[model samples]
Target chain A: MLQAAFVLVGTIFFAAVVLAVFRIVRGPSILDRMIATDMLVATLICALAAEMVQHEHTRTLPVLLVLAMTAFLATVGVARYVTQQDRPGGPQAEGGAAEGSAEGGAAGDDAAAHDTTSGRAAR
Target chain B: MSAAELLDAGSVLFLFAAALLSLAAGIGIVRFPDPLSRMHAATKPQILGLVCALVALGLQAENGATVAALVPILAFQMLTAPVSAHMVGRAGYRTRHLRRDLLLRDELADAIDKAHADAAHHDVEPDLPGLVTDEDTSTPRP
Candidate 1:
């Protein structure tokens, strides 16, 4: 009876994980998607560990550890990368490029003009 | 089996609770708007969920060695989950893209500024030997 309960609960958890994978794939932003993927990986690890317990398979513990470690490291690495992109003069340092675009040139000029006026006001 | 055969019922209940918590965590991670909020959801729920599940496994484990083996994994997870979340949060702040309205003070933002100011005061060149030999250096190489 206990084993059956575990099996049922584990199966439900696995279904939720599948839905998380879809969110990961369809997230609007890269960070959103990466976070979803990280959650999916974590869910998968827990599910595997639970399966091992349900089956009384001690050998599977090592495999679960390896997978969890890999997923954790990968998630951290990607999060770091995305965070770096958010920095000033980071990969998204396209403020200058936006200025060069004809459609944005007027706004850029206005910003520059505002800066000069502010500087003069400060003086 | 008699009522005496239900000795491991608590383990089954805990396992069920853990599974439900994990599912809630998955929903939280997907639904939270920002990284910081999501990090809160991810770490806290996962830690609780894992603890519950591992405790249930430990209760059902037949031998001392198997239960003992479970201890280290739980300990390591408890220690590392918050550290990983901290790193992700710091990285987000350093990048300056996080939604400031969501944050209260932005302590990390101040820290990054102080670091940059200290580096500037020291006139530390990026090419200086031993300054950035490590692989994780954020400064671009010539």
Candidate 2:
């Protein structure tokens, strides 16, 4: 019964890997790709953990730590890079565009984008 | 069922749930319409799935050493996942990948505007303590 459950979970993990890969490849924006990549590492960790349960494997635990750390650093590094982007006017222009959408009366969804850009203000 | 069988059953159940949650998170990343929403999918369920799977492994751990090790692993995951996701969210917002239409309440508009304005006169962090003010502060800005 335990083995069977492992197999079932393994199948699910396999499907998750395929789907996450698709998201990474098809993700439209750089940030979309980043989000997909984050999901992929998470799926990998889940799959590995499931395998550890099935095989009675207790030796390879450090690999999980290594994977988590790598994912964390990579994500933070990229995020810092994106936030401090060198483009002088890009963030401002986008901010303006978001505001314009708010005032121009596309109020429903546009407000979300506007408010998030300046989290402090909305508070 | 014997105690051993019951233990295995518990581990199996946890692992199964973990796998399904992981799959759902993956599907969320693929299907969510925007970056922020995709972030919602990416971090929360994924962390829960990781914890579930790790807990299952801990349940089956044969040695005290193994369970001991598992303790710190779970702790680290709980600590790190959100920080990474938050950093990503910040990057996405600054980069403007966030879809305005899907957003519910963006608290940062004024901060970004302040930062935008501040960029001209001096180098200031958009979220510098004084930069962001309450709603009343939104008015009277030159």
Candidate 3:
């Protein structure tokens, strides 16, 4: 009876992980995607720990920790990359441009100017 | 009921509840539209669910070695999950990509921008406190 109950709960947790994966794939923004990934990692850790209890296996706990730590690092890395890209003169500078010519380059410069101006005003 | 039977019943019930709560937390993260809300779903549920599951495991564990191993895993997770969430949220705020309508007010956003501006004026690379830095931005990248 106990084993059956665990299997049922484990299946539900697995389904939730699948739902989170769908969101990660479909998230409109990079931030949303990172958030989904972080949630997915946590769910995976719980599932592994549950399995260890059901099977009476002690080895799986360390494996779960390693996986969680790796996922945490990956989420932080992606968040850092996204923040860096959004900075002025960063990789997404072109995307911030208003036109497709030297005018576009000027427009990107204007955006940077606006950012600095607003940044100053807020101070 | 016997002592062994009672322990078995409690362990099974706790494990089941923990698993369900974890699943709900995952669903909340996926369904929430913004970073802060998703974070709300992520941090609390994950920590609580893990604690309950670990407790259940502790109850079922037969020996001292198994209990010893489980305790550190629980402790480390309790400490680390929140720190990681804070880092991700700070990064999102610094990038200015987080959805604004979702926030009531953001004092951290103001602070980060001010720090960045100050660093820019001084020609210094702003380093996040306690973070390990790999590259110095003052040098030209090859």
Candidate 4:
């Protein structure tokens, strides 16, 4: 029963990873990508813990500790950068306008892109 | 079933629950409408899923030391997940990544507008703490 459970859990984790990857690819904005990446890391951590449980060992526990501790730093850095970029007369002021226009267009296109992704997922 | 067998069964159950949470989080990230809404989805696996998996790990641990080691993983995740979520959500809000129409309440916008009006009022003529009237304090400058 335990063996069967492990296989079932593995299959679920695999699906989770695939879905997270899909979100990463389909995410419209940087924040959306960041959210997907965060979820992906959480899935990875859960997978590692499941492995430790299945193997009946502690060898990978440290890896779990390190991953949990540091995963948020990337999110913090990206958020700070986004906030800074939005500020007028900030270091990236010149390029911000161009990027903002492009992002605006992407936002306009978001509904269509969302439909395609959901359609593909459903199919 | 013996004690060891029972523990193993418990661990397996917990692991199954964690896996389901991860699956849910993935679906949420894909289906949520905006960054803030997606954030609500993404945080499930980070906190609840990790807790479930750690509980499973604790149940299956061979020794006390193994269980002890699992503590920090949970602690660190609990500590950091909120901080990151706040930062990301704030950035999303500031960047206009969230759908304003979908929001039920917008206290932040009200506060921001108030602050901007105050700043503009101050920019025109700086307020003196001593000279500031009660009426001026009660109603914000237009």
lDDT (Cα, tens digit) per residue for candidate 2, span A31-69: 777778888888888788888877887766898877776
Q: Put down candidate 4 lDDT per residue, A2-35, tens digits, no spaces.
A: 8999999989999998988998886556677888
The best candidate in terms of lDDT:
4
User: B1-142, model 3: which lDDT tens digit per residue?
Assistant: 8987787778777777777776787778776755667777766446777777778788878888887887777777767677678777876555544445556787864776787789999999876553222233222212
DockQ of 4: 0.38
Tell me each candidate's i-RMS in Å. Answer: 7.7, 5.6, 6.9, 8.4
Query: Which structure among the candidates has the greatest TM-score?
Result: 4
> Per-candidate DockQ versus the true complex?
0.20, 0.41, 0.28, 0.38
Q: Mind sharing the TM-score for model 1?
A: 0.67
lDDT of 1 by residue, B1-142 (tens): 5543454676677777777776776777777656567666665335677777777677767789888877767666666566566656655544333444556685744655677678788997333221111133223311
Per-residue C-alpha lDDT of model 3 across residues A20-120, encoded as one tens digit per residue: 78777765446667777777777777777778777878788788667645667777777766644443333444432223222323232244344323322
| Chain B TM-score list for all models | 0.70, 0.76, 0.72, 0.83
Worst 10 residues of 1 chain A by lDDT: A108-117
TM-score of 4: 0.78
Task: Give the least accurate 10-residue stretch of model 3 chain B, judged by summed lDDT.
Answer: B132-141
Task: Return the candidate ranking by lDDT, descending.
Answer: 4, 2, 3, 1
Give lDDT tens digits, candidate 2, residues B10-90: 888888888788788788888877788888888744578888888888888877888788777777777878888898877
